[model samples]
Target: MKKPVAAVDPLRLLVAILLLLPLLALMGFGMLWLWQSGYLLYWLIAMVVCGVLGYGLQQLLVRQERQLLMNAATEPNPEWPPSADAVWQQVEALSATCNPEDWPLEDGRWIWDLGQKALETVAHCYHPEVDKPLYELTVPHTLLIIERASRELRRDIAEKIPFSNRLTVGDLFRIQRWKVKAEKAFNIYRAGSILINPVNALLSEAWRHLRERSFDQARNELHRWFLRAYVCKVGYYAIDLYSGRLALGDENYAESVTPESKADLEQTEQTAEATNEPLRILVLGRSNSGKSSLINALFRELKTVTDVLAGTTQALEPFVLSREGFTQALIFDSPGCDSPFFDSKQMLITAGSADLILWVSPANRPDRQAERQFLDALRSYQAARMDRRSAPLLVTVSFVDRLRPANEWHPPYDLTDTTNIKSANITAAVRAIAADLAVPAEQVIPVCLLEGKIYNVVDTLWSAILNHQDEALRIRLMRCLDAKKRAEDWVLLRRQMAGAGRFLRDLPEMLGKRSEH
Candidate 1:
């Protein structure tokens, strides 16, 4: 409980009365003497007037102080969202003190002192504790709960509170109480008692601000107090979400895939020892749609046979593609989806073993009905063998040069500005084909591949491929899908965002339930 400013010193009061007795006796003797001399009548009238005026002023001050105190005591706390602005400001002020120029050495250390005062202030109000000395409460006889709260907050936030954050309702409610305690601390600190401390003069200066109605000076101190307790209550969860654990590209996908990942790696090694490669990606599309060319481009060599025919490659052709910084991957150039020879079972066998699937289509083709059917069948087939997670599909619209005026060749196309004929054609084709295939617009990429020619192949295609490869690896680790499984980036992000949204939405309810418990 919050102790009083100081214990009552009865000995001092007794000494004061004893000392006043002689002065009182002398004044009585002088007054009696003056009355007998008949000269006290005028003085008595003046004394009575002065005494009545003093009593009236004292009563007025008392009434006003009591009203303000009652108003402050009865003020209901605001809800989380409504009070968020002040709480946010409070958090920022505390964060700013982390690097104070005037008191660099005392930056976060002062927070502990403030937190102690806050806890004691709250205890005094709600707990059945008798008034005691502040020195006793703050120093040698400090409560365990206040000490632990300060220590935990100091450790969790690294002693530097966060400035701006999406602090949940739970955090705000907890902080609201700390804020309450802090304000009470200020009220007590203003009493000018013998609660000796290093900050006594500073508290007096802060309390003096109320004369001018400048609450910031005192409220700022209270804000610092609230921040420490806020950190103790909600800081850990804040740091976790702020770190972006759910986002992709995090090494190990923000999780340690330890013992079980090793087992999966061993099994993968035994099964694919012949290739000894970590990943195998398949480039599949309609015949003559640049599937073979894309593979050869990835290899930077004419390793796969290419022909301008509807069914040039009637079988699967595998080649190795390696990059300086990336793991070596086996790239397979599969037959066109329209190739009459390959049935549904054959399609899965060709695609089932691959770690990733890259679907290529021509930007020049206006109708993708055939390609759409093939993709749908492939998705179902891949899903049946793999988990519901579709294999990471990176779709590339190759032959962008073949999009416009047949003769027009362009190295770069600004898809957004549709005035340029080639760019316009490319934009329209991508939009139409993407809409027709029911795939996200971002997945539909435009590229042109020719030996010794570079266009969108590097700028667009390779970037998307490398990105999808990482997700594919993460999924492999997740499902132990050595045989074949794919995870889409959109799917991963959507699920992550959904989970986050649910958490934020349910936070108030969770706090209510916990409070009941």
Candidate 2:
């Protein structure tokens, strides 16, 4: 049978001190008044008498009250044994079980188990009918359990891996920090709050740690924890967002594929060059901006058709195209760059490693998001190059054939006839879009990559590539990419510096508040 829990007394020994404070203050004040009136002996006598009387009365009252309570109390029960010995024994056992040699793996497992138990305990203890006790007792207990678990895990990791070894130490610290964060998140979750951010952060860090190590044990541990963490995060976020518990605002929540998202990571062990390296062409635009159709059209002209959608091209697809001089270059079709889903950081990282960037846009519907992303990516590419020169920014205006009536669609236009009205109209339209994109008017070329009888569409693209194959063009492209990258870096650096300045300025005030507490 469970023993009845006693209510904690609000009035403790400290309450007596609080109650006597006013009387003591008044007595002191009276003595001071007497002394000022030239009654020093009287003041001293009164103070001594009151101090002795007050102390005696407080002690006597407290003793009598305790005696009365004790007389009314029931007989002591032996069924409920004291818990101190059992708790100490458990602590000793735990200490003995946890060894430094077993380190991160053993400690990590222990923490994981403790966290699960704590969660279960709290869930069982929580009662809407007994809100105060449930919150005050159960919530704190849960936090302590999580904290203890986290501390144990951190200590174990620290002991197992010395700080000097970059790989081991870095991975261990990352995992430990994540465990701490997970504890904080679990606390928040118990209060009916979402824990997606921390869970995501934890899993992300764990993924990095696993990727850094080749050891089977570490890798297995990482995979297990990462999956669990990711499931928790995804489920929490999905529930909260769908149920209107979390705000989505205007931010895009498109799933991003990180290095850790790969299922067969062993494939990554191979050199990047061994794979079919495609000339990654980045198509940028808003949704429904004909970016998909443009790729379709290009593939159609090349006598091929492939999947088209943002992130549809899971991996870069390389297509070999032969030019007039029997020259060939690999062309790559990439995922469309759309607003919200367009990760500039990842895109720039990819662009830095690409040989060329084919910036594609549709003639009918132009998107500003696509234009801006392209420029940003190009800038990043230039910055990453050894020599800062702009890569050949080949701008292609797709679906030009759509401008004419379907039945009257022509294959090619007369370049020599400057007075040709139809040719002039197409040229003007292409130039206008180019101007909007901030690309040079001369660099923009209109090509109907989809037209069955497309005149010189392939030739035009090939010619542009051939013309810029020289060392000078390479140098120029590199410079342009570098300049753009530098500009972005400057902007980011300035913002970061400003933020640091603000933090420094406010630190003193924060510290002052903390000290007072």
Candidate 3:
């Protein structure tokens, strides 16, 4: 256990007393010598200056203690984050008497690898039903719950700004500009007595800790108060919002809204006019490979129904995703490769029209021949005009939990961990898929959209996308959108040209005019 050190610790007091005694003795000796030399004025001045300096030192210590307390108050809360130790233990213990095909513990310790189990554990901590078991949970629904919870958590964190630190006039202006959102949340909370009730106990506990001089404890309590107040109370509306989005579905259609007032209608018109359209992301894959589930996961809402049955998607479905911080994007969940009604021409057109393409394949499926064929065809058709390499393809491999040695779901595995069979298999799987698709290994991401559990898709997928978001490519995509209603493969050349119809349009027309013999 560590000992607590306060600014006004007893040791400092003792040191001060010791130093003061020595200072007094030295002054007394100096005064006596001055008196003997008849220098009384000099002795008096020296005595007063030394006394003031000693007093200032004490004041400095007092000020430091106050600052320390303030800093502690602003610090983050203590959280006992949930883990998958028990889950992994069960898997490892069960596989203890296995052959080489087994789940292994780390360094012979009880520690397991950090993968799907660990990911779900962390997510479950913020879950509305915190103690829910992994097997019993519904993956997409639970993830949607977690997303709402986390978003509320962020909003609560934002509310502490004005109270968090001292602000200059300039700081206040910047905060006001940034705090439109914070103020809105604050207003909603203040507008009701009901919203503040849930956090009353937390506030009381925090106050008790503060008065008892337990600064750290107080900080922890206040953090709980904030999180609870926003996520639990103010966030009650989130349930309705999520449900509405789910029921309404991701189907975008033309609609007309007439405001009651002229000014309101004008404002609505202005807002719509100013709004930039979101980027279109088309998810491609084989049937039953979790395309709809991936889209719902991204939205954090069960907007689309998921099933193990193939041909679940019948048409090209488009959904708008407005995740905070990123640009609003349109994500389309398309019909799987194996759909009986699958039109190759339409699939080619849809894939080419997208601003981004997410090819979701199953990790367990050894033969990705179906998806590979579609991808190859899609590329070849586009290559008739522009460089096929211009398209940014991010392949997401799902069902990673089903990879061999069934129950093993630890993470932190890599192509480098030679000792671990799980790691070796995962790396091999990724490499094989990358080779089949003719894409780099980095472009292929393995995720365990673990059924009845949210796993590695969100962070790993988004991170890969952001990394590959080149400035030139983004500008080109934006230009394509502007020139045409949708960004298509044919328009890719327009992005590179100074003017539309300069290259292909002119050349194609000339060739047609000459005709064949």
TM-score of 1: 0.42
lDDT to native, each model: 0.57, 0.47, 0.55
Q: What does the lDDT read for residue 178 in candidate 2?
A: 97
Pairwise TM-score winner, candidates 1 and 3: 1
- Flag clash pairs in model 3: 113-411, 114-411, 115-410, 115-411
Count of residue pairs whose backbone atoms collide, per candidate: 2, 15, 4
The residue-by-residue lDDT of candidate 1 on 1-517, one tens digit each, is 9977656467754675566556545555666676789977766666557655655665566556444433322111221112223333443344445322333222556555544444333333323355742333323124333444445554644433344235554776778779887665445443323233323334335435443343333333334434534432332222111221112233343133233323444543543433333566778888788998887777677777788767888776656566875656656677787787556577776565556888888877766788888788777775564222455788888887766587888567688886888788888888887888878889888877887665777667778877777766654443332221123345666888999999999999999999999
Candidate 3 regions with alpha-carbon error over 4 angstroms: 1-274, 387-389, 471-517
Candidate with top TM-score is 1
How do the candidates rank by lDDT, highest first?
A: 1, 3, 2
Candidate 1 lDDT trough over 10 residues, lowest sum: 74-83
lDDT by residue (tens digit), candidate 2, 1-517: 9987655335643464465456545555655676679886764566557655655665565456445433432221111112222322333333334333443443456445533433333322233355353244334334444444344435433443336235574686798789887765444333221132333334334444443342444444333433333223222222222222232122222121222112212243322322222233444444444444455554444423433444554444445443355322344455556645556667666555444566777777644656765686666566554222344566777667666443456557764456765566677767788778878876777776543545444567557656655532333233233334444457767988999999999999999999999
